[model samples]
Target: MKSNKRIILHYDMDAFYASVEIRDRPNLRGKPVIVGTSVITTCNYEARKYGLHSAMSVAKARGLCPNGIYLKVDKEKYSRVSKQIKNLVLRLTNKVEFIALDEGFVEITDIIKSYLSYEVFAEKFKRGIFKNTGLTCSIGIGYNKLSAKLASDAKKPGGVTFIKDIGEFADFISDKGVKLIPGIGKKTQEILGLKNIVQVSDVLKISLQELRSILGYNRGEMIYEYCRGIDNRKVSSESKTHSISNERTYLSPLEDKEFIWSEFLNLLVKTHKRLKIQKFHTKTLTLKVRYLDRKIITKSKSMNITTQNIETLKKLMLELFEEIDLEKKIKLLGINLGNLSENKEYQLSFKNIENIKKERKIQELKEKINNFRKNIV
Candidate 1:
């Protein structure tokens, strides 16, 4: 055992969207509540028992559980609740890394060393969240980020587990599926299965040379270390935005090119608004599409200069959209702004300045419309 081991804690909200709906609408409790129309974003535990999970078709989920309640996603409401949770975590530790709106990692080495036992601290933390927001989360405590995340998921819906040493980490994961380890998706799992590496322990028996031959040099080395419970990733709470985007799934597929272009423009507007609010600019823009048959595809383009201008984003996204085979009815459209930078004061070209002026005019017009409606009402 290492004397100077870091104590990392991963906090993940249980069925975040479904849980929030249940908390707000208590009658929905213990029911199979699904949270989307085109694709299942998530469902309550009751729905999970019926084989309903995130990304499954709502229609398929209905076939599985006909009496299940379906609801639209409330982004604004969820964002507000997520912000509350983030603020609460910040009160505990500044060393927090948010994986999503509902999941975060906190480095608690200093707090554990200074004050209470890990168990006591976890209990109090869970109690605190319920008291303030009426939400439950699972906590995982381990020497590294990967172990901590896996530990948190071990017992879910308000359970906590601690893996303090290599022995404990190894024993805990040995019997689990190879896919249980991070980065080993369905494809990688099949590739490993061919090599007779089905369980985490099987990975340990294979030589590094064998792993490299099967899974390439970089990925093979990473998994080899991970199987042995060695992860050196740090918990960081720095300002970083890898991407910002907006997406919408249609209840019915559309085939009209003009309507699809209009929808893309709407999504681009949303992406631009979010980028401005987050104070970010991007050098890459992506267009994501989902066909009626559930085939998902993405096209991305890189720019010479980073930008947050709507006109620039619209141009890039339109170009990506043009390259796609949109003959088939589209079920979803999304705009992804990536290669992000936090440089808010970057020099803009004359064209960008014109775009900014147009944006301001649009905002002014929206404000006037709202004010006029308020006066009339």
Candidate 2:
């Protein structure tokens, strides 16, 4: 059976924070604008031309471009503008998925009648965003989510690119770095680099068994398919939260085992309280540890039964920590509870019935004595 051709549109705002700053303060337009302190969260096209990009250090950015305009992030202002953009896109279709704050995927396959209609909608959407927020965006239309995302990336700042077929999608990403493929991050890059696999084409040429050995089972299998331009994910409008987490970063990296254990336990207790407040029960616990050199390792374990019990959660977290196996100083540590569901009433077990009966008898005796004292008075 043949599959229906999908019309997924990937929308990404152009240098979102920096662009918003430039829009409000028109004088900053042609200058190199940086939108963060301590770290470069984003930069304008002028800054990018000077080899400054997001996540670069402020000192390094200044060294690279001495005349760059640095502005603190106004999260409230940006959030309001983001809402305007999201509303504009939602008017076209309800099938949308958000990425971070500025990027989104809209599945317009059901609403659009033909390719001509898709083009028309794209132009109108771009015009609407600029008119309302004074910001420009890049849009990509493709047969699937991955292609759409790559297509948008290919054409930045007020450009639109389309990948209508699988052949076009494969050709577009063939020479690109493996990092460009979704979900292939720095750790995967490090592992694949050791095998001399640096490009998407390299991933395409590697055997399944070899890839599995390097990236473990699930992620390896998925990337093997992604290299060939295949992505089956839907553009869901509302994806439920699978987990909740809390983390702490140390001012200095921790080297002592005792300090690390204490910190881990503290974070776990905070996370558990949050889980209870949210009325959620989880079967899986995940521990995230970032090392001194910025490399992060995560380990998770699943329980035989779901629970919200503090003691049970603590026990599971300790077991998950054992899987880390690294003895290095840690820069950051986090606890995450996953495989979640709403909390339900606990059922009584035969072992606990005797305890409940004894508690009831004690309550009755106390009430009777109080009544006798009242009558004597």
Candidate 3:
């Protein structure tokens, strides 16, 4: 069958940041190591015993594991190691989609043919990563991305899992929590929980139309397919850029609307600059706010016409930003310019001439400032 022909592999680095730290500092191997300044980005398995996990507050994590080694994030070091692992993956197959620095999907249907079995290939690939980087990875081999991702997460710190049959995949997730499904975040989980749809099996009880009515159209349709072990997402090596975004997590949560707006504007300017540099016009502007309680809310506005104009984007951004509740202290603010299309040459209307001149002047000023800073450095 078509399902039997496809092979997808999800590769996840085990406790990536913490593992990297432990590898560099042998003394931290068995001890609980927590990485992050304000929020816990990740922790070693030893720390998990104390109910410590990603996104937990560092202060709370300290209370959980008082003697645990706390370390600040070293993004540059982790990124360098991630590149090394990527290079190793590229040597095996170029059909790879790296969703994050530590996790990615690879379509290995063609490459797996050279191996005696899928298990053998997974072990060999795991060994290659460990040999080169001194870090272990878990790999999930399956017929689709969803199954493969779940499989990879099933085992950790150097383990391989394979879910080849659709029936097997369905059985595996049947008793799992609905939150276990990708894209079903806390908000969706709460909504589902209201309807007593807590488990994967509970989702199966509802009809597609019922789910759509509950979650609107798109998300409901997606959940319907995912719960049935029917994901058709391709593992593309050269995926098109869908959005350009910038986000900042404050060391301390801010309550002042004016200060938050100023920070929000900075993110908008940075994101807009990237959009212009990439020569893409965006139709949708999204604002994401993360409250101190770790709950996140997003509001989005889609324009009738696509634009790269900073003024137009700024207006849209303000509209979305205003939708956020300022009564709650917020820890993070993010802006996303999406529904992107390549900027193509077109005859400008008289109305656009002044805006174009203003943008050019701004770009020139930025270039001059950057050059001056470089010279001084």
Tell me which of candidates 1 and 3 scores higher on lDDT.
3
- The C-alpha stretches of model 1 lying farther than 4 A from their native spots are 1-3, 291-300, 315-326, 347-377
Q: Estimate every model's Cα lDDT from 0 to 1.
A: 0.89, 0.87, 0.91
- Ten-residue region with minimum lDDT total, candidate 3: 343-352
Q: Each candidate: how many clashes?
A: 0, 0, 0
Which has the better lDDT: candidate 1, or candidate 2? 1
> Could you tell me the lDDT of residue 266 within candidate 2?
93
Ranking by TM-score: 1, 3, 2
Runs in model 3 with CA error above 4 Å? 1-4, 252-377
Q: Residue 6 lDDT in model 3?
A: 89
Highest TM-score scorer: 1
Report residue 231 deviation for candidate 2 (angstroms).
0.9
199-245 per-residue lDDT for model 2 (tens digits): 99999888988888899899998898888878999888887778989
The best candidate by lDDT is 3
